[model samples]
Target: MKILALESSAVSASVALTEDEKLVAQSFQNCGLTHSRTLLPMAENLLANCGVSLADVDAIAVAHGPGSFTGVRIGVATVKGLALGADKPCLGVSTLEAMAWGARALGGDLCCVMDARAGQVYNALFTVEDGRVRRLCDDRAIKLTELAEEIGEAPYFLVGDGADLCYNTIKENCTGLRLAPAELRFATGFGVAAAALPLFREGKACSPQELDAFYLRRPQAERERMARLAQTK
Candidate 1:
């Protein structure tokens, strides 16, 4: 299957094209530009360079949620438009899962995390065995201390944009934790494609309208608003 995937769930954004399990073309940028400006252009450039358009792609995939709320919204919205326009299937892979898929080559425990701020991270656990990723936990927003306790010294590679923060916060407590290399630390378009292909084969793809963001918690503004309301009440 030809899959076109987009990733903008964190600081960096990337677009990738994959044929079956092989990544054919990818354009990545971590230059601090707004995803709205960089994402579509990158996808267009990647497809154009690959000599394939949306019509040629069998599925449109995105890393949805558990990172920047605006970033996840942009990615999911982009995929929805492209898939709807091309009449292609839509794959909404978890941002954490996509990171895990990208690091499948590490072949051990994977602790995917994204900085969710306020001493918390968006995280999920996965184990890669024989080149396939098996999810160990549902995606969640968790405190660093709780996460460290749950991990309990088992050897694991930290992944995603928050790897460094997570590692530093709990490193003393979790002796077996190691930071993944720089290249494997962030979510990428290729990772989204890698995570989506299996779901596509399992008949789990959705329509454009059904594809949606998966933020683990409400945005900070919303939380603050609720807090204010509670104080007034």
Candidate 2:
């Protein structure tokens, strides 16, 4: 199956084209917070290099997130537009799931923690045994302290940009943890998109309207508003 995949759930913006589980081409830009500006253009370039157009793709896959709200929306909205125009099915892969794929070579309990900000992270636990991911903990927001307390006594390899951000805290908290190598620190468009394409072939897709980001916490703006209301009282 020919699939077009998008990754804009973080600071990086990337696009990938895959054919029959093999990578054909990818375009990635991680210069700064420019996913909104560069995503479509990157997609265009990747497609052009692969000599394929949106209509030629059998399905569109996206990282439906527990990520940057703006980043996730940009990716999902872009894919929704392309899918609608091309008349193709769409797949929503979890952002954390993609992280697992990037670290499939790590060979142990995989902990994915993306920065949810305000002293918290969106974390999930998975064990990769026999070449497949088995979820040990559901994805949700937790304070770094809470994560450390809850993270069990097992050798874990952490992935995601957020992991890097909280390195000191992790070392202090998640005791006896084994960190994954730098190469597997973050998700790649090729890795994530390829990992999610099977569902597209199996007719496991959601309506565009039903596609949603897995935000583990309320938006920061909402929290600020609630704080102000509490102060007023």
Which candidate ranks first by lDDT, i.e. highest?
1
lDDT, candidate 1, residue 86?
Answer: 91
lDDT of 1 by residue, 54-138 (tens): 8899999999887899999999999999998899989999999999999988889999999999999999999998898999999
- Residue range 1-233, candidate 2, lDDT tens digits: 88888989876777888887678888777799578789888888888877888889888888878888888989899988888877887888878887887688788888887888878888888888787677787778888888877775556788887877655676766665776787676767776676687677677876666666667667788989999999999
Global local distance difference test of model 1: 0.94
What TM-score, to 2 decimals, does candidate 1 have?
0.99
lDDT agreement with native, every candidate: 0.94, 0.79
Residue 114, model 2, lDDT: 87
